[model samples]
Target: MNLTGWIVYNGYLPGTKFRDFAEWIQRAAANQGIRTTIYKNNHLLSCLTSDSVGLVDTETRPDFVVFLDKDIYLARQLELMGIRVFNHAEAIAASDDKIASYQVLAAHNFPVPKTVIAPKAFYNTGADTIDDYQKAVQLLGFPLIVKEAFGSFGEQVHLIHNQQELTDTIQQLQGRSFMMQEFIASSYGQDKRLHIVGNKVVAAMRRHSASDFRSNITTGGTMEAYQPTQEEERLAIATAKVIGADFAGVDLLIGPDGTPIICEINSNAHIRNLFDCTGINAADAMMAYIQQEMRHNHGRLADLP
Candidate 1:
């Protein structure tokens, strides 16, 4: 497949890790004979004028884009320009918002921990009425998990053990978007991550954190190669498709009955950790999927019968 594209990641993110992701994807594209240019999202300013959306760019637009950031407007702008973006903008938005992701998953009848979305409120404005919070706490019970709608690496998730604790936690959040979920005790310090690409589970790993209730690698979790059960694999694949992801890192929690439940879905899941743990390069799979899709969409798939 002959294609030109752009790989965009956040430029202000202060770390070599994200840039490293872009480079790895670029290398994969190169191996497939696809030419790509890397761009920090900020490098291409999104221009908005009366009746038109465009990017301030002097260079010619590419055939497609591999967007690794959550700049939804920019992704939409690219779509408006007829540039295909991997993991479509709508999907990214759903995945970026924890509340939205759960709503979709529940609508599809997937198994998820009991969850309650906090009502919209301002930071300093008092949620003075603990009445609503009390009802939610009663339904979810103590030791429930309070998670911000928008967060990564388990940093925004907190384990609340009591009514007062819950109130304190919310107060600390200062009106940020958050939700409450039933704590999966069986999966307290360990969870499984299955990376899927184009309907296939490309890699799987178990992440464990002895020191924390959260099992995120960024939060002191350790990784080890693990094989997913058939049910686990099925759930992961279904989840990626349900969320409309080209590729995703689906986190699964162990239900009390030992069944897999969706912990989260990441549209822009970092591949470096998966690579280090499973030795599988998801970028390769991602690039291959993109190429096949691009060619098929352009009526260039050689396998057409």
Candidate 2:
């Protein structure tokens, strides 16, 4: 029997970008003869009762979900209903929070920049205390990076060159979870994005910006096809595995001596840019991986308790 899948994306996000991502995945699955449906995350209402977990989607149930949304609750809800979700909800939640992602990487002995997570602030509590700021400064030093735990497209990332700048940024991001990290001057305006599918690197690219510290394409950076060294490839694959992602975009920074250090892992990374840069359709690889997994585990996933 043919398998069906649901590509779930955020419904409330403005613009076509989020929806576009789902479509790309859907098309890739269609190319392989897998029937796929696009569902807005909000359309699937997660329902819970004292003794039951259920989701209300008017459409037919799918055998699996290609979850492209950051709505962790919705993802988990679908999982509870016995449908497999690629990139898993827990992985998505961890990847969505920069601090959580860093902690997971560090725990697994992955090479990462020195990082110090800010103390959680109560809501409407105003600015953070100066002592906490001083602690982070002492740990990470000046010219460090201040990044909100939950942000994307490098928009919430700030470069702090002094105590004043650090403190100012902290105040500006009051009541939000964030972190400070050592700046890798060697990778100031460039980084590599490796798209890992299953156990291997399917595509890679170098993103660089002449005018910005971040190399994210959303920030006007340019992309070029990249060849990953063995070390870079291993790090990318290991990081993705440790984070429990079936597929991921792992960003790597060059350390002082040219060693690769992980910058971040993106669980719901879009496939369009990787396709444009490397001429490799990551969505195709993802769909193929899913089909292989389903076949290998045929008549077994339903038996999973």
TM-score (C-alpha, index-matched) for candidate 2: 0.96
The per-prediction tally of clashing pairs is 0, 0
Candidate 2's C-alpha runs over 4 A off are: 57-59, 299-305
User: Whose lDDT is greatest here?
Assistant: 1
User: Candidate 2, clashing residue pairs?
Assistant: none
Taken over the whole model, the C-alpha lDDT of each candidate is 0.91, 0.90
Task: Return the lDDT, model 1, position 92.
Answer: 93
Task: Encode model 1's per-residue lDDT on 192-292: one tens digit a residue.
Answer: 99999999999999999999999999899999999999999999999989988888889999999999999999999999999999899999999999998
lDDT of 2 by residue, 1-305 (tens): 59999999999999999999998899999999999989898888998899978876454678899999899998898888888899799999989998999998898888999998888886636645767677678777879998999988999999999877876777888788888899999999999999999999999999999999999998999999999999999999999999899999999999999999999999988888988888898988999999999887886856788
TM-score of each prediction: 0.96, 0.96
